[model samples]
Target: MDIKNKVIVITGGGRGLGRAMALELAAKGAQLALADMNREDLDTTIGLCMEQGVIARGYVANVAVEADVEQLFQDVVSDFGALHGLINNAGITRDGLFIKAKDGKVVGKMSLEQWNQVVDVNQTGTFLCTREAACQMIELGNEGCIINISSVSRSGNMGQTNYTATKAAVEAMAVTWAKELARYGIRAASIAPGYIGTEMVMSMKPEALEKIASGIPAKRLGKPEEIARTVSFILENDYVNGRCIEVDGALRI
Candidate 1:
């Protein structure tokens, strides 16, 4: 469907790839409802979208919290009167090896706190937001799409047991939702991005990032805008569902 003037909600729409996707959709003339825990950064993104002459609003919301996510969707429907799409983009990482060892003994390990932190935001958080979005679409009897932001690490990444697990689960959720929600005219899909040159990744040491980029067949970090393009493609093509598109520069793991 044509996305112009359609009301779409985005989680983590404050910074990084989420910001890029918001601006990209704004450029396409879509109305946006953005939710983020960081109010200041969320305002910055909203300002940018307003500059693009698109209808935009931001909510101070924690995607991991069910009440916050519920209110987010409520506000979207209240203000916009309809929902057309949702991007589940809020995520966090607490990277650590499965076991941190010293002198042939385990000194530390991936704590339950660390694991739950990633899973809460990346896994349960996604599930909450997606459920709310799907509920809104189904209740209102509308056709829409849900996009989950996954990672190349979903296949399994060292030092990211928690993150990769959630990502892999996210893709699985998309497939399940696609099949289940298809009857409601709701499509589900995921985008697995490689090392994108976002603010977060760019904060790493240049040499560190260089080594990481060099591993990619593209010889460069993927751009946030590039991932945004895939969102546009998925949104327009109604038949594409239950799939994960890898915008990874051909980088595995």
Candidate 2:
């Protein structure tokens, strides 16, 4: 589980937490396959890794597509000749109340489109990527780790019914994968973050941001590198498997 010179694939590595994790791993001498739908952002991440003297490449991919996930792993193995780990970090949020209310009266329900988009990318995408990673690890007979990015919202949250369900499902799947793949020397784990100061959170109303910060015992939002540090910790700690580590600042949300 030494990260030095290990081959790792990070989905949604274009920006935010994924990019931060990629940078941190690269600093540890890990080779990287950075996958994301945003080519420009992916290139930026690759540039940063290259500057650090790491072997890294970028691939544009939609994690929601099974074929894309399969092909991404294929391309990584073809280029790197081995696979060591994978980070499932691609996700999107389509927030809406399950039952929309206008003046305390039910007006409309969550749109089917919103629900489907969130589930497809957040849930199905994780499944596809994890399946592909597991297959590659087994085929190569290499010990590997898979980290799925989850959220504190998995417990439950207002205006996040779809997101909550998907996050919770993946955490359960992480445990199941650990049990099923332990004999093969593959490990599965998850990181559940709360109120991280990513672009998505930065764009929220100032008052809302302050309110969330107030709720967190830390009294401030988390940084992407904070989460990245935890990822590196998991990568180095071989005994940490099938567990979901919370990166929140004592925030139970």
Candidate 3:
């Protein structure tokens, strides 16, 4: 599981935790095939990785689409000649209460659209990407690793019924994949991160951020690099499989 010169594919590599992971792996000499929906962001991440003196390429892709995901893996192998790792980091959040009520009367409920949007990108996207990646690995006789980016909210969050459901599914999927794909020399695992200092999270009001940090035992937000490092650890450790690592700063919810 040596990372040097290994070809790794990272979905959602345009920004945030995915970008952090790309840089970390590049620093360790892993070749990168970065996929994202944003061309500009993808190019920026690629250039950053290239500056680390590793081979980095960018592809515009939507992971929820079967055709897009299949083509992504094919394109990566065509370019790198092998697939060694995949990070299912592409996800979106559509937060809403399952049932919003006022004065004992139902005011609103989670829309099918909200549920489908999150499920399609987070849960189904992970499934599609992992299936295609596993096929590539087995056919090429390459030992590989797949890491899904789950969330602390998988346990259930008040305003995130859709997001929570999908997060839980991705974690469960990694466990199932670990059991199913062992004979093929591929390992599957997941990482659930707490509130991290990503651009989106950091942009929240300072008072809101402080309240979040106060709730965690660590009394601070997790760094994107912390999760990125965990990804590298899992990929490099052959024995670490079928488990979800919580980088949540001791947060329960």
* lDDT of candidates 1 onward, in order: 0.93, 0.93, 0.96
Query: Model 1 Cα displacement at 102 (Å)?
Result: 2.8
Once superposed on the true structure, which residue ranges of model 2 sit more than 4 Å away at CA?
102-105
Residue-pair clashes, model 3: 0
What tens-digit string does per-residue lDDT give for candidate 3 at 1-253? 9999999999999999999999999999999999999999999999999999999999999999999999999999999999999999999988878998999999999999999999999999999999999999999999999999999999988999999999999999999999999999999999999999999899999999999999999999999999999999999999999999999999973
TM-score of each: 0.98, 0.97, 0.99
* 1 versus 3: better lDDT goes to: 3
The better-scoring model by lDDT among 2 and 3 is: 3
Clashing residue pairs found in predicted model 3:
none
Best by lDDT: 3
Query: Per-residue lDDT of 38-110 in model 1, one digit per residue for the tens?
Result: 9999999999999999999999988888898899899999999999999999999999999988999999889
* Runs off by more than 4 Å, candidate 3: none
